[model samples]
Target: MKVKIYGEGAEAQELLDKVNNSLEDLGLSDFMEVEVTMDEELKNSLSISKTPALIIEEEAIDFRDTIFEGIVPSDEEVKSMFISIIGGGGESSGGCSSGSCGTCSTGCH
Candidate 1:
Protein backbone atom coordinates (compact mmCIF):
# COMPACT_ATOMS: atom_id res chain seq x y z
CA MET A 1 0.00 0.00 0.00
CA LYS A 2 1.12 3.57 -0.76
CA VAL A 3 0.02 6.67 1.10
CA LYS A 4 0.39 10.20 -0.17
CA ILE A 5 -0.07 13.46 1.68
CA TYR A 6 -0.61 16.52 -0.48
CA GLY A 7 -0.28 20.10 0.69
CA GLU A 8 2.17 22.66 2.04
CA GLY A 9 2.95 24.33 5.36
CA ALA A 10 2.46 23.15 8.93
CA GLU A 11 -0.96 21.57 8.47
CA ALA A 12 0.41 19.25 5.82
CA GLN A 13 3.39 18.38 7.94
CA GLU A 14 1.14 17.63 10.86
CA LEU A 15 -0.92 15.31 8.70
CA LEU A 16 2.21 13.55 7.54
CA ASP A 17 3.38 13.09 11.09
CA LYS A 18 0.03 11.72 12.13
CA VAL A 19 0.03 9.25 9.28
CA ASN A 20 3.56 8.10 9.97
CA ASN A 21 2.79 7.62 13.63
CA SER A 22 -0.33 5.64 12.83
CA LEU A 23 1.55 3.41 10.44
CA GLU A 24 4.22 2.77 13.04
CA ASP A 25 1.72 2.08 15.79
CA LEU A 26 -0.10 -0.38 13.56
CA GLY A 27 3.15 -2.13 12.66
CA LEU A 28 2.69 -1.24 8.99
CA SER A 29 5.36 1.39 8.66
CA ASP A 30 7.69 -0.92 6.77
CA PHE A 31 4.98 -2.47 4.64
CA MET A 32 3.77 0.82 3.19
CA GLU A 33 5.22 3.62 1.11
CA VAL A 34 4.61 7.23 2.15
CA GLU A 35 5.23 10.56 0.47
CA VAL A 36 4.39 14.20 0.86
CA THR A 37 3.91 16.65 -1.99
CA MET A 38 2.99 20.19 -2.76
CA ASP A 39 3.01 19.65 -6.49
CA GLU A 40 0.06 21.24 -8.19
CA GLU A 41 0.15 18.90 -11.18
CA LEU A 42 0.06 15.82 -9.01
CA LYS A 43 -2.69 17.28 -6.91
CA ASN A 44 -4.67 18.06 -10.04
CA SER A 45 -4.21 14.54 -11.34
CA LEU A 46 -5.82 13.26 -8.18
CA SER A 47 -8.55 15.94 -8.26
CA ILE A 48 -7.40 17.12 -4.90
CA SER A 49 -8.99 20.53 -4.56
CA LYS A 50 -8.03 20.88 -0.96
CA THR A 51 -4.82 21.02 0.95
CA PRO A 52 -3.82 18.24 3.36
CA ALA A 53 -5.50 15.57 1.31
CA LEU A 54 -4.66 11.94 1.89
CA ILE A 55 -4.56 9.44 -0.94
CA ILE A 56 -4.11 5.71 -0.48
CA GLU A 57 -3.08 3.51 -3.33
CA GLU A 58 -3.00 -0.25 -3.61
CA GLU A 59 -1.04 -0.98 -6.73
CA ALA A 60 -1.77 -4.68 -6.70
CA ILE A 61 -5.42 -3.86 -7.27
CA ASP A 62 -4.66 -0.80 -9.41
CA PHE A 63 -6.49 1.31 -6.91
CA ARG A 64 -5.74 4.83 -5.70
CA ASP A 65 -8.40 5.93 -3.28
CA THR A 66 -8.69 9.26 -1.54
CA ILE A 67 -9.26 9.14 2.20
CA PHE A 68 -9.80 12.80 2.84
CA GLU A 69 -9.29 16.31 1.50
CA GLY A 70 -9.13 19.76 3.16
CA ILE A 71 -9.50 18.18 6.57
CA VAL A 72 -7.52 16.15 9.02
CA PRO A 73 -8.94 12.84 10.08
CA SER A 74 -8.59 11.47 13.56
CA ASP A 75 -5.66 9.10 14.02
CA GLU A 76 -7.95 6.26 14.95
CA GLU A 77 -9.99 6.82 11.82
CA VAL A 78 -6.87 6.64 9.73
CA LYS A 79 -5.77 3.43 11.41
CA SER A 80 -9.22 1.93 11.02
CA MET A 81 -9.24 2.72 7.33
CA PHE A 82 -5.86 1.11 6.88
CA ILE A 83 -6.94 -2.02 8.72
CA SER A 84 -10.03 -2.20 6.55
CA ILE A 85 -8.05 -1.67 3.37
CA ILE A 86 -5.78 -4.60 4.22
CA GLY A 87 -8.85 -6.71 4.92
CA GLY A 88 -8.26 -6.70 8.63
CA GLY A 89 -5.17 -8.84 8.29
CA GLY A 90 -3.34 -6.65 10.78
CA GLU A 91 -0.18 -7.98 12.39
CA SER A 92 -1.79 -7.89 15.80
CA SER A 93 -2.23 -11.41 17.14
CA GLY A 94 -4.94 -10.31 19.50
CA GLY A 95 -8.71 -10.29 19.13
CA CYS A 96 -8.56 -6.65 18.11
CA SER A 97 -7.45 -7.88 14.72
CA SER A 98 -11.04 -6.89 14.04
CA GLY A 99 -9.80 -3.26 14.44
CA SER A 100 -12.52 -2.29 16.87
CA CYS A 101 -10.04 -1.65 19.64
CA GLY A 102 -10.75 2.05 19.60
CA THR A 103 -14.29 1.32 20.65
CA CYS A 104 -13.33 -1.00 23.44
CA SER A 105 -13.67 0.79 26.75
CA THR A 106 -10.90 -1.31 28.28
CA GLY A 107 -8.60 -1.01 25.28
CA CYS A 108 -7.21 -3.62 22.90
CA HIS A 109 -5.88 -6.96 23.90
Candidate 2:
Protein backbone atom coordinates (compact mmCIF):
# COMPACT_ATOMS: atom_id res chain seq x y z
CA MET A 1 0.00 0.00 0.00
CA LYS A 2 1.10 3.57 -0.69
CA VAL A 3 -0.11 6.86 0.67
CA LYS A 4 0.49 10.08 -1.22
CA ILE A 5 -0.13 13.46 0.25
CA TYR A 6 -0.56 16.21 -2.33
CA GLY A 7 0.46 19.73 -1.44
CA GLU A 8 3.47 21.95 -0.85
CA GLY A 9 3.49 23.45 2.56
CA ALA A 10 3.65 22.84 6.27
CA GLU A 11 0.17 21.37 6.23
CA ALA A 12 1.24 18.71 3.80
CA GLN A 13 4.32 17.92 5.86
CA GLU A 14 2.21 17.78 8.99
CA LEU A 15 -0.09 15.26 7.35
CA LEU A 16 2.92 13.19 6.47
CA ASP A 17 4.04 13.28 10.08
CA LYS A 18 0.60 12.25 11.27
CA VAL A 19 0.53 9.39 8.84
CA ASN A 20 3.95 8.20 9.90
CA ASN A 21 3.00 8.43 13.55
CA SER A 22 -0.20 6.53 12.95
CA LEU A 23 1.62 3.81 11.10
CA GLU A 24 4.15 3.51 13.88
CA ASP A 25 1.42 3.41 16.48
CA LEU A 26 -0.38 0.68 14.58
CA GLY A 27 2.77 -1.34 14.01
CA LEU A 28 2.42 -0.89 10.25
CA SER A 29 5.51 1.16 9.55
CA ASP A 30 6.87 -1.38 7.14
CA PHE A 31 3.59 -2.23 5.49
CA MET A 32 3.21 0.98 3.54
CA GLU A 33 5.12 3.67 1.70
CA VAL A 34 4.29 7.27 2.42
CA GLU A 35 5.26 10.37 0.50
CA VAL A 36 4.35 14.00 0.01
CA THR A 37 4.28 15.39 -3.48
CA MET A 38 3.84 18.76 -5.07
CA ASP A 39 3.94 17.54 -8.63
CA GLU A 40 1.45 19.30 -10.82
CA GLU A 41 1.00 16.35 -13.14
CA LEU A 42 0.32 13.96 -10.30
CA LYS A 43 -2.08 16.35 -8.69
CA ASN A 44 -3.81 16.86 -11.99
CA SER A 45 -4.00 13.17 -12.73
CA LEU A 46 -5.60 12.58 -9.37
CA SER A 47 -7.88 15.58 -9.92
CA ILE A 48 -6.87 16.97 -6.60
CA SER A 49 -8.85 20.18 -6.33
CA LYS A 50 -7.40 21.23 -3.04
CA THR A 51 -4.18 21.36 -1.17
CA PRO A 52 -3.53 18.81 1.58
CA ALA A 53 -5.42 16.06 -0.18
CA LEU A 54 -4.70 12.43 0.62
CA ILE A 55 -4.81 9.46 -1.71
CA ILE A 56 -4.39 5.86 -0.66
CA GLU A 57 -3.58 3.32 -3.28
CA GLU A 58 -3.17 -0.41 -3.04
CA GLU A 59 -0.98 -1.05 -6.04
CA ALA A 60 -1.28 -4.84 -5.95
CA ILE A 61 -4.65 -4.60 -7.67
CA ASP A 62 -4.24 -1.06 -8.97
CA PHE A 63 -6.73 0.14 -6.42
CA ARG A 64 -6.67 3.86 -5.72
CA ASP A 65 -8.99 5.61 -3.31
CA THR A 66 -9.25 9.26 -2.44
CA ILE A 67 -9.56 9.57 1.30
CA PHE A 68 -9.97 13.32 1.52
CA GLU A 69 -9.56 16.63 -0.27
CA GLY A 70 -9.39 20.24 0.88
CA ILE A 71 -9.05 19.38 4.55
CA VAL A 72 -6.76 17.92 7.13
CA PRO A 73 -8.03 14.79 8.80
CA SER A 74 -7.25 14.11 12.43
CA ASP A 75 -4.57 11.62 13.47
CA GLU A 76 -7.18 9.17 14.70
CA GLU A 77 -9.12 9.57 11.51
CA VAL A 78 -6.06 8.74 9.49
CA LYS A 79 -5.41 5.70 11.66
CA SER A 80 -8.96 4.51 11.25
CA MET A 81 -8.67 4.74 7.50
CA PHE A 82 -5.61 2.54 7.55
CA ILE A 83 -7.32 0.12 9.88
CA SER A 84 -10.35 -0.10 7.65
CA ILE A 85 -8.23 -0.66 4.60
CA ILE A 86 -6.07 -3.31 6.25
CA GLY A 87 -8.87 -5.04 8.11
CA GLY A 88 -11.13 -5.10 5.09
CA GLY A 89 -8.57 -6.64 2.80
CA GLY A 90 -8.01 -3.52 0.70
CA GLU A 91 -11.69 -2.67 0.69
CA SER A 92 -12.38 0.08 3.17
CA SER A 93 -15.11 -1.06 5.54
CA GLY A 94 -16.07 2.54 6.20
CA GLY A 95 -17.58 2.69 2.75
CA CYS A 96 -20.95 1.31 1.73
CA SER A 97 -20.75 -2.14 0.29
CA SER A 98 -23.75 -1.57 -1.96
CA GLY A 99 -23.31 2.16 -2.52
CA SER A 100 -26.68 2.72 -0.88
CA CYS A 101 -25.62 3.30 2.71
CA GLY A 102 -25.06 6.98 1.86
CA THR A 103 -23.07 9.69 3.59
CA CYS A 104 -20.66 7.48 5.44
CA SER A 105 -19.05 9.34 8.33
CA THR A 106 -15.87 7.34 8.36
CA GLY A 107 -14.17 9.56 5.74
CA CYS A 108 -14.60 7.04 2.98
CA HIS A 109 -17.17 6.60 0.28
TM-score of each: 0.76, 0.79
Tens-place lDDT digits, model 2, residues 21-45: 9999999999899988787887777
Count of residue pairs whose backbone atoms collide, per candidate: 0, 0
RMSD per prediction, one decimal?
Answer: 6.3, 3.8
Error of 1 at 38 (Å): 2.1
lDDT of 1 by residue, 1-109 (tens): 8899988888888889889998999899999999997778767778888788888888888887566788776777677666766667554543333535453332321
lDDT of 1 at 102: 57
lDDT per model, in order?
0.74, 0.75
Where model 2 places Cα greater than 4 Å from the true spot, the runs are 88-109
Residue pairs with colliding backbones in model 2 are: none
Best model per TM-score: 2
